[model samples]
Target: MTPIVRDFRPDDAEAVAAVRRAALPFMVTTPEGIAFEVDQASPAARYRLLVAEEDGEVTGTARVGLAHQSPTPGQAFVNAYVHPGHRGRGAGSLIVTTAEAYLAGEGAAQVYSWVLDEPHFRTFAERRGYRPSRPAHFLRLDLSNGELPPLEEPPAGYELRAAADFADDPRPLFEAEAECTADEPSDIAAELDDYEDWLADTWSHPDLDRDLTMVAVADGKVVAFSAARTDGHTRYASGMTGTLRTHRGRGLARLVKNHSLHRARAAGCTEAFTGNDADNGPMLAVNKWFGYDICATEVRHVRELG
Candidate 1:
């Protein structure tokens, strides 16, 4: 029987999480995270989580959604994954086709997906009309063995604090995220103007580890931050680490990220992972400085739909 594609059911959480981890080990995802991603997505995102089942066993998953944060309309994305053991069963194609039709029906003019750098994966995406766009690198650090840079004292007038410090009001962190995200390189530029959306999508995310997310505050303002997310187990991932434009000259990005790494190590995290746009030299340099090694590469693939 052909695989069945359908909206994610509550019980599909673990299966979806398993598929994602197997397909992209560098990223962190959990059952709770999967549920939260679909349940808390903003309406403008037009988000949908789909699972492909064969013989009553879940074999693939895909997340389809509009790039609601992008300033450009009709820009959307779909990321699909099939278990290595289930690859030739048509689960991957069915999920991607379903996701694209849904996205195009929702008014998306262009759809983007990330294809693994491996030749087979690239060929599969190309066959589906997804031309290469940009590449990204996934870096890994063995927190259990590799030596992490020792935590350092903040420079004068600069202080380090966990994101938890902003529990009463995360407006400062929100402002910092908005400023840094706008400057980050991307195929689809994003503008974060909605604080409520950020609060719902980011600040409250199930995987966000507020206590381990270090922030660099200068003159009582958030100048830089390293957002941390964990799988509630051994995997710790850097959601993002960025410095404000005005504070670029300083080493705040490195400072906060190193501090967060120390926190993660102390919290029993055995592995740390982060991704960088292949063109993001500064961040790549920072990860290198932290002894991270490149583990995998993924290329952004785009398909223009008329």
Candidate 2:
């Protein structure tokens, strides 16, 4: 079967979402979410949503882009997914070839990607000259029947609020994100310098569940938060949980996450999912405290683009 690769169309959202869901079940995805990503992606990143089709059916998809948020220059990322039934058909290779060509043209020195922790998949990345760096695990919690830890009253001078409560003004949340990002462990450091861009891509994403995203406020300032993303079905994920540098070590991160999980459970979410680098001991401890179990693992791989 001959496969043709082309830019994605708005109507192709379902096929693209299907590809992502089938290839990566641990992550939450939706058609509307796909459209939102392509629509709001910053131009600096040069984001491209590509799909590989055989005859008239979409079988593979790739999200290729530069890391615009990263302070490091010329860093690129490409995450591709192919339907399980369509393996060994050259679709994956074609998508990677297309992504690398684009990234290389943009003067990217290195490209980062995540490959599942499987023998056959690792062999493929090694064959393509990619080296493993950091490993991350995806955790899942069965929330349907399990008894969640009871929410506690906020400590003095601290109040718990939903992310939606700040709709009128989210600059405080942005400030918290900026501070927390400074501590995240990543090869490329990110700087969240623009609030307008965050509004478009992060705050306004189709799947972001603001009502379930818990925020910690101190003296009317957003000091910590646990963002939530839902599939509008039964699955929920911790988008990002961060505490301002000054607020760290106060248990605010864990506090907001617990509040968010309870909100999600009350909102009919049956399962919770989150991912963290194996080296992030603090977050790993927090997730373990929440009763989340590691369900899947992936290793970040890097390769120099020719």
The best candidate in terms of TM-score: 1
Query: Each prediction's TM-score against the native?
Result: 0.99, 0.98
lDDT per residue (tens digit) for residues 36-139 in model 2: 99999999999999999998999999999999999889899988899999988999889999999999999899999999999977888888889998999999
Candidate 2 differs from the real structure by a C-alpha RMSD in angstroms, to one decimal, of 0.9
For candidate 2, what is the lDDT? 0.91
- The Cα error of candidate 1 at residue 204, in Å, is 0.6
With a 3 Å backbone cut-off (N, CA, C), the pairs that clash in candidate 2 are: none
Q: How many clashes does each candidate structure show, in the order listed?
A: 0, 0
For model 2, the stretches where C-alpha displacement exceeds 4 angstroms are none
Alpha-carbon shift of residue 279 in model 1 (angstroms): 0.6
